[model samples]
Target: METLANLESFVRSADHGSFSEAARRLALTPAAVSRNVAMLERNLGVRLFHRSTRKLTLTEAGEAFRNAISGSLSDIQAAIAGAANGGGEPTGVLKVSLAPTFGTMHILPLLPAFIARYRGVRPEWHFENRQVDIIAEGYDAAIGGGFDLSPGVVARTLAPAHIIAVSSPAYLAGRKLPAGPADLAELDGIVMRSLQSGRIRHWTMRDAAGEQIPAPLREVFVFNDPAAMRRSALLGLGVAMLAVPDVIDDLESGALIRVAPRWYADAGAISIYFASRTLLPGKTRAFIDYIVDAFKQRRLAERFAGSLG
Candidate 1:
């Protein structure tokens, strides 16, 4: 009989691309993981992995088996976990990815309340600027904008990602303000570059009358991180296009001022994403419900909408 231990070892090893990595994740030694995998292969009467000194690749049979059993294994584990906890409350580590500035400014404040409500649940969150492969990296959830909807993942809209032009009061003190998107060509521009493509992004600003105009910016400084760009704008380096959520506090405090009030860009919706599983972990489920409800209660979507003054 193939035991659950053997199956878990095989799956983790395959997912991690090495027995050592799998053992690290499973909290076991490499030799033990190898033994479990060997036992599994002997029980099945077939070799599952193509092992080499430098690489371990799944064979055709192994790939087919993994595909057939992966989903069922997740469901079975979720079931067992549910039964073990008596369906009471979630008890486990919830791994999540979040954007650095937005997550800290908004979501981090909600953590105290969340911990008070679900004491059994522990959060292991990472703040970054890049998109993560949720399943492959073992992340329970991620919050961001413009993420590609990979297979077996779902998303909920948290807010509209409305982008607008901003500059520090000092930077605009002596400079003529932009009357329209086209007028921005004369001012120094702080621009964001794509991390994946290494190209500067361009924006087409839209007005209340539904007129779209391409922003003609003279790029004087470039940054890959939005937070860095915001800082640069605050330092009076140049005008930058930033999401409303990122600049709302600065705008309210008079550190940053809107350049073209009549123009904003629709960047897409900021969303929370998680795996689409039939038997989701209680921790994950609770987080999803809590966050969705919080967004609705806070009316963050309306606040994030780029409204002209």
Candidate 2:
């Protein structure tokens, strides 16, 4: 009943804290994880975790087992990688999560080649607006706006994201359109809900001297989803602050106009986020390299027109 495969499942379950999540990560069924953990417990004469419908926790014995095994396992992973790099093939599933906007606009369109080039790579993609806990959710990697990884997990930048203050031309009608950054105080517009966490994601602008300035908020419509905010903005609902990629087409088609020249800010540079360097498959590493090179090749900065640079 006890085998290395079962032990591997136990380790994965302990790491992820949920049998279902571990199963997802391993491409196994939840029942498989449960059975493996049960076999491990029977062999060790102890329970490793407290299981419930909604949560999982390790027991005292389970904690000790992890302390003993986690390192050796990590080493084993390194050995495997070294061998694979030497001559072996890398075959595995790669799971990734991404924000809806970036996933749809940038990532999804570019994934086909990754699949085609790598014959052994299988990918499962998760796209959502809400933030995801990568470790707990059993993801191999992620691409999104915010970066708050758990201590053990790590991340890298895929590209620099730029944001712009935008408004419908119809909303600017008869409103004494703001002339510069300081003039924003008197104007009202739609606001992204995510930007208004306790305080508004105030508009950022630049003066003639190129000094960055903040524009205060007076908003009536607010939504967290950029796509939602974009729709409202297009309907002449109100001026809205949003990421440049979200409104690139609108700006080109004369749907949404820049509110002020100085309001664009390079939202922190975001890149491919993933777990540690251990046990990485060629698919993930190769795909990441492809995307990073592609983004750099396209010159995201030049495309976004940062501060008229």
TM-score of each: 0.91, 0.76
* lDDT for position 185 in model 2: 68
Off by over 4 Å in 2: 1-3, 16-56, 59-61, 64-92, 195-213, 305-309
Q: Give per-residue CA lDDT, model 2, range 43-68, as digits (tens).
A: 88899999887889999989999878
Residue 34 CA displacement from its true place in model 2, Å: 6.1
Residue-wise C-alpha lDDT for candidate 1, range 25-94, written one tens digit per residue: 8889999999999999998988999999988889998998998888877887778877887989888998
Pairs in clash, predicted candidate 1: none
Clashing pairs in 2: 157-271, 158-270, 158-271, 190-239, 193-223, 204-263, 205-262, 206-262
Model 1's C-alpha root-mean-square deviation from the true structure amounts to 2.1
Instruction: Pick out the ten consecutive residues of candidate 1 with the lowest summed lDDT.
Output: 300-309
Which stretches of model 1 miss by more than 4 angstroms? 208-210, 307-309
Top-lDDT structure, candidate number: 1
